[model samples]
Target: MKASRWARAAALLVLVGFTASCGLPRVGPNKREIYSGSVQREGDAFIVSVNDRVTRATAVVPALGFSAAFRNAGIVGSDTIRPGDTLGLTIYENVDDGLLAGQGLNATMLEEVQVDGAGFIFVPYAGRIRAAGNTPEAIRRLITERLADQTPDPQVMVRRVAGDGATVTVTGAVTQQGVFAIERPTRTLSAMLARAGGVAVEPETARVKVIRNGHTGEVWFEELFEDPQADIALRGGDRVLVEADTRSFTALGATGNQTRVRFETQTISAIEAIAQVGGLSPTTGDPTGVFIFRNEPEEIAKQVLGRTDLIGAQRLVYVLDLTEPNGLFLARDFVIRDGDTVYVTEAPFAQWSKALSAVSGTLGLASSLASIADNLNNN
Candidate 1:
């Protein structure tokens, strides 16, 4: 009886392994395009381990593409004069002995001078002086010097007419839309938005695009406040647009949640992002196989794949091995870019557990069948 029982138990174990073949390591959930490909640009994506070389050379993404725009912040809102400017000139001379006093005219006179197309402003005796690229104080000194020969100790003053020139074009998603002049010292992006009565709609989806000259820079509206770098200086003729942020990403597989999530902030790290989607399912999630699929830019993708022949594949799969302690750290630092797909692989033990369950059922069934046979033989 003992030998027979042992044989039966051994048979059940074999049946369990055979029936559970489907639950193997390379099962359906684990064999997605993200796991199969080696290079990113190969239609499907392959995992690129986050190492020092890759991390240093190929930056973990969510690249805001704001570098070019942030760099231009230094150039906007210069006090230097430009064409289409209006200046307020006040000439004061001592009634006893100054240049105006010598002219036998009024001791003080106020004149509003409009800058011409050539960026030159005309004075009574100064002819045409170049006002462009010069500040008001510089222009005032220049005028004083020019009138020095005309009269004894001439006192001249120059000022920019308020609400006159250097205006920023505020359009798109503004409660108050108008052409507002950029006050001296150059106004910031937030100042302009406030002037427009703030955003009309919920700020959750708003994005601010600053287009200056031929270079255009776009950033999420919230970011403009959180990071000063994003609030670039507004220049004359610069177009500022506040529109909805349309970037989103899809989450699938064993994650706690599977849906399209919009970018709520300017940037998000992988760890917090996973939490936002309910994180990996404890019951079925594979701690070793957290992955992110993204169709990234060619330049950014190259940093990870290190392949020059990236002809067909713009798709990439980034993985985090949650089983390793280091993975948690990497996840904290890893950035999740817009349009990325977050997925967690099914647990490796899920198949084993199912197969063992089947075996246990088979064992109980075999035991009952054997008892019935013994009863029949005795009868």
Candidate 2:
């Protein structure tokens, strides 16, 4: 009986050792396993060490902007007339009962004179006159000259009212959505947004998109105000839209929170990203094995790896060792791009702890069974 008891104890010890060596369940692969599955070991992914040089090379911030054709375009004149515009004209005759007025009146008031699609307006004696592309003063001069031959020393005044010309359509995340005129104070992108009662969303995450002549240009709402060049001039028939940012990154493995986290600011560093997810798991997280998985474009991949042989987008795993002296600084400088996966591997000892706990529970159950057998035998 003593030999059997010793044999059972030895078997339990062997069983515990086998279970531990065979690998217990883990949250994720450890540092050594991750490294073994790298491109150097015929894996599909390339493993890169995040250092000062890599941080600088891969510190890319995504920016939205207009093309040269959109940015270089000149500002539209506020007073210029165009088709679908309303003009208010007042014509004064030097003498009563002249060509434009009766005996009691000296002026003829013409309100709501709409310019035709052909860019011409018809007056009594002026006939068909080109009104589009001319300012109110220019049109006043032309009408005066035309009526001078009919009425002696005729004086004319042309006023521009609410018109479709030089107007932009403002929509999306704004306080109000409507077609706004590109007036003197609201001719640029920033002014137009202000005229629409400002953006309704957070300024840091707001995105402004302008579509002109079937071409689209986009810029951040904050950037549109900060960068003067980004506040391009608005044109007639331009559609302006304001929206919120949609960029996000996934947090997995031994992180404090495993989920998809949206960007809270216009730009964020890796350290900020980890903090946004409640930081790493204090108990199970491996501080030396913080990894960032990203699919980088070919150009960026070349810059990051210093090699041009790779084509198209390449999968890259960047390792960050927070144990290093400058690791926090390095993380602070490393930009977290859209659609990145931040994974924190579990510490090596965490798996060992789990295995030891399992073994201890098994030994307790065996001891309980042995006590039951001895009690039955004594009975």
* Model number with the top TM-score: 2
Model 2 agreement with the true structure over 1-379: per-residue lDDT tens digits: 9999999989877776777677688777778878887889988888999998899888888768999988898888888899987888999998878887877899999987888998999999999889998988899999998888888899999876656666789999999999876777888999989999999999999999999999999999988868888989888889999988999999988888999998889889999999988898888898899999999899989998899799899999999999999999999999999999999999877777777789999889999999999999999
**What lDDT is reached at residue 338 by model 1?**
72
lDDT of each: 0.72, 0.88
Q: For each candidate, how many residue pairs have backbone atoms clashing (under 3 Å)?
A: 2, 0
Q: Residue 26's C-alpha lDDT in candidate 2?
A: 73
lDDT of 2: 0.88
lDDT of 1 by residue, 1-379 (tens): 9999999889877787797774444333574545546544454555676654554544453334356555565644446677887777877765565544445654665565878888898887777898988888889889888887776667777766533457788888889877766765448888889988888766856877777777777776777778877777777777788886667777787777888998776557778788888988887778778777777677766667777766653766777886686888888777777777887777867777778877778778999999999999999
Q: List the residue pairs that clash in candidate 1.
A: 41-313, 42-313
RMSD of each: 10.1, 5.2
| Model 2 spans with C-alpha error above 4 angstroms | 1-17, 20-25, 86-114, 121-130, 134-164, 368-379
Instruction: Choose the strongest candidate by lDDT.
Output: 2
Worst 10 residues of 2 by lDDT: 159-168
